[model samples]
Target: MAETVSHHLGKGRLVAVEGSLQISKSEKDGRTYTNPQVIANEVRFLDWPKDSKKGNGQSAGYDDDNFDVPF
Candidate 1:
C-alpha cells in the first residue's frame, strides 16, 4: 500500500514509513483500538532535489503583506 502511494508522488521527495496498526483490546471497555507502530529502522527518504535552495524558496507576494503582528 505504501509503495502505491509513493509511486503516485511522481519523482518528488518521498518518505517511506513502514509500520502496522497494532490492534489491542481495552480491558476497561472491551473495545478494540488500532495504534500505529512505526519501525524506527524502516523509515527512508528518497529523491531529494538537486538544489536544496532553489529560487530563494519563498512564496510569491508574501514579502509585502500589510498585517501587524503584535507579539
Candidate 2:
C-alpha cells in the first residue's frame, strides 16, 4: 500500500495525508507495551515550492545543505 502511494507521490512531491490511529498492546518478557499505528486513508498533494530550483535544481525545502549548520 505504501509503495503504491509512494509511486503516485513521485520523487519530489508534497502531500497532506490523513489517517487513523490504532492502539495495541503486547506482552514481551513479562512486560506490557503499548504501540500506536497510523493507517493512511487519504492523501492530498500540495503545490510545489516556487524556489524549487534555487539550490541544486531540487526543491528548496529538501536541500541537504540546509541541515549542515553548526550548533
Candidate 3:
C-alpha cells in the first residue's frame, strides 16, 4: 500500500522526507520537478534507530530521527 499527500510550495520552499518518494512541482508553478530525477533529490533515509521494533528493524519514531536543517 502507498500513501499520497498534497501541499503548497512557494518560491524556495523546501521539504525533506525519509525513505523513497516521488516529488514534483505542479505545472501551475514555474518551478518544475519531474519524475525519478526529482524524487532523487528530496528523499533520504535517516540514521538507523537504536530501537529494533520499527521499519525493517531500522528507523524509529520521528523524534528519534535527526532533522539537521534549520528550516
Steric overlap count per candidate: 0, 0, 0
Ranking by TM-score: 2, 1, 3
lDDT of 3 by residue, 1-71 (tens): 11211222223434455444655545546666564523322333344334446647443333446423221
Question: What's model 2's lDDT at 62?
Answer: 40
Question: Candidate 1: where is the Cα deviation over 4 Å?
Answer: 1-13, 17-28, 49-71
State each model's C-alpha RMSD to the native. Answer: 13.1, 11.6, 11.8
| TM-score (C-alpha, index-matched) for candidate 1 | 0.30
Question: Whose TM-score is greatest here?
Answer: 2
Candidate 2 residue lDDT tens string, 1-71: 56545544566667766878899999999999999997777655454444555645455434444322111
Judged by TM-score relative to the true structure, which candidate is superior, 1 or 3?
A: 1
- Across 1-71, the per-residue lDDT of candidate 1 in tens digits comes to 34534333345555565555454444447766655554333444443434344356332222334211111
TM-score list, all predictions: 0.30, 0.44, 0.20
Task: Kindly report which residue stretches of model 2 are placed more than 4 angstroms away from their true locations once superposed.
Answer: 4-15, 45-71
What would the TM-score be for candidate 2 when compared with the true structure?
Answer: 0.44
User: What are the Cα lDDT values of the candidates?
Assistant: 0.41, 0.58, 0.38
